[model samples]
Target: MKQEPSYIEALLPILTLVGLLTMNVFFFEDTLAGSNQVALLLAATIAGIIVRRNGQAWARTMENVVSTIGSAMPAMLILLLIGSLAGTWLLSGIVPALIYYGLDIINPRVFLITAVVVSAIVSLATGSSWSTIATIGVALLGIGKAIGINEAIVAGAIISGAYFGDKISPLSDTTNLAPAMAGTDLFTHIRYMLYTTTPSFIITLLIFLVIGLSYNFSEAVVDVANVKSAIDGAFNTSPWLFLVPLILFVIIIKKVPPIPSLMIGTLLGGVCAVLFQPHMVSEIAGNVPNYAEASYIGFMQAMFGDIIIVTPDADVNELLHTSGMAGMLDTIWLILSAMVFGGIMESGGLLTRLTQPIINWADSTGSLVASTVVTCIFFNTTASDQYISIVVPGRMFRKSYQDKRLKPEVLSRTLEDSGTMTSVLIPWNTCGATQSRVLGVGTFDYLPYAFFNLISPLMSILFAYLNLKIRRYELDEIPVEERIN
Candidate 1:
């Protein structure tokens, strides 16, 4: 029979993973792209060797890995659908319509503030930071550049607003994932999150306001008319395009499952593309002979592959491309690798052993919450995936919170505050990489200006330290009805 791993042995894999990830970041810089995935797999292999030597069956270890990855499949599916939705929305002119209209209200003096607000509204409506950034955020970036604002500041404002809306919106995958991981319902988690989220948002806006007022754009003239004209020349920009998103919001409000709701949204986008953008669709088809064949090919390309709508203006052309479902494969690969490592750590008791010291040190409510927050951030940095950050920390800390008689919503809120918001700030993280690619801004360039993201973790930590709004479980009653089974 194999023997159980010692605590030191349990920590070896995590330390090794961290060391490799650090080196990967240092050596590869922006090109550290898939290095984290390799590091995770290597670490998992190390973990597997240790566990196998400790009496754990190889079959059992594989089972745990499979099960862990299976649990994350829903999130993976959502990511894929999000890509499909983005592509179709771009092809359908829904995104351009938003950009066309959004540019109309840009007060150059308060352009940063406008970018933030516009990004927030779009993200909240779509329940997707990625989509918001790729679409309206891209447009905002162009507008900001045309108005002579620093690209980093524009990128920061866009990211901050998108994440804020993403954190609270029930339609958001992270919003749903955080509560699910922490053993709470969606609405409860969102409501509790507001206590910290609201202050952070307000502070972010005020800071942007001050920064906005100090800017002198008197000589810079943004040709809003040309932007609108370019969009009009490319696609059928109309209010009717918004019906697709409105229907999505209504479905989400009606409590439809996210997968189904997003599926409906994707189909709606595809239909809109076919109906309103026939000439564009035919161009995408490129000599398919039959109009019907061309439309089918074009729509399919937009839904599942790369599609670029080349506009007369180079800047507009940059904003008019989508990668569809195929674009999500890299993220999926990263997630799967992270899950393998997480599974091995969990099944072999490595995570529990590592967290035990933190648990022992967390004698008070504040310390416990702080520990949870730190763990989430650590995972985000080390594992390089936001979902893993939330899942691993939530799993590690759930019983600790229960023992402390803390409500699940508190744990859920902390996960989002630290884990969800900070992911985009890390250069090599999946969230960070994706956003940087979408917005054409490096993570470091936007990091300092992401006021809301910077403030959120601090607010959660501050609230915990002060015991502000910290809900404890009643002594005579069960703490949370939805505690993980």
Candidate 2:
């Protein structure tokens, strides 16, 4: 006989998972190296056991797990390509050139705010925060480091702006997905979101501006010249190197799929390395006499293995090494492990079981929106994927909003404010893990500093409680069937 899980049953795997992950922090210095992945797998096993005991077949649970992993395949592939792209870009001097030129033009006093604005514009234009963070965000971090700012704080600024642009951009997948899940039109959701989003973004910028101005850059000024000189000595820091990223941005804006766009970027970076940094390429190839063999060997190494460019300055050398596609394997392992846990919990209805009380408690309008935000964050933490966070909560709350005569855009906007924004804050979530690996900054390290992300959900709740711009549907606009129900 089939049995429905009790609340305790639903909570068991999650509690166990959280406890294990917490223990991992104390036990391992680098948790993501393997410990975190093991923790996820163990948690999935516990969930699988519960599902089987609840009368779901093991085969069925495995099927769901397979489907979930399949869905994450695209993300895993993109990570690999990004790793390769970073490697080749470094080899080609594109990254160094950006850092070199950026140091010359960007004032250390205003660099944090500038990073935020620059990342925002790029993310807004491309409608992809991932691409923006991987390419330009990496360079910005290097520039920030050369100027003596903490990498975590710089990463926070980059993520804040990137996510801000992603949340509002018409082309963003999450922006589109939120509306679809909540039964709202795209433009309606976006317009309604500005009421809360605009304020949060303004506050974020103001905070960064203040932090930027407070910094004393007297010492960093000396280091910047040394950094630029080291980069200039190692590779050709030509303006032409900027063309590779410009072309990548154009392809992203033109709506080419992410995988193909990343692949193209990686190849273009390789070509640029051969054309513009031939001497360095030969050096990377162990100074082989034949230029053709050296080019082939260097390009292959940049795409798949460790590549380093030693510079006179130690800080510059730190910025010049890359691990290529092989480095992304740990992140991929984490994603697959997370998906396994998510699949089991979802297939067994454990997540819904756990969230039922939250929905039930959402009687008042303010509480309803608050509940939605909490549920979305909960899902982001437990499910380890942002799309699941939006989809699950949006589906759960859509009817509740309609029943309360709230506009669907309210639900959509709340979903973005919480779901889309907070996913990158959770260490195990796909967005968080990928960004951490890409930027070489830990998720928790930047969480406190990602002001925009930290503020968005609170902003959403504040609006709902204050009845400020909380749009309600006119009685006439409510469907007759819903009114009767």
Count of clashes, each model: 2, 0
Model 2: lDDT of residue 346: 77
Candidate 2 whole-model C-alpha lDDT, 0 to 1: 0.81
Worst 10 residues of 2 by lDDT: 476-485
Error of 2 at 165 (Å): 10
RMSD of each: 4.3, 7.6
Candidate 2 regions exceeding 4 Å error are 108-202, 208-220, 361-450, 459-485
Off by over 4 Å in 1: 1-4, 26-33, 121-158, 165-195, 214-227, 287-289, 379-395, 398-412, 423-448, 462-485
- Mind giving the per-residue lDDT tens digits that candidate 1 earns over 1-485? 86667888888887787777667655664323577778888888998888888888888888988977776677677778877887788888887887777666677778888888878876775567877787667777887777677899989999999999888875576786787666666666877999999999999999999988877764233445666777889898889998988887687668776677778888898899889999888888896779889878988888899988787766666567778888777767767887798788778877777788899999998899888888888988986767667866876787788878888899999999999999999888878988998888999999999999999999998999999999888886653443432
Residue 117 in candidate 2, Cα distance off native in Å: 5.7
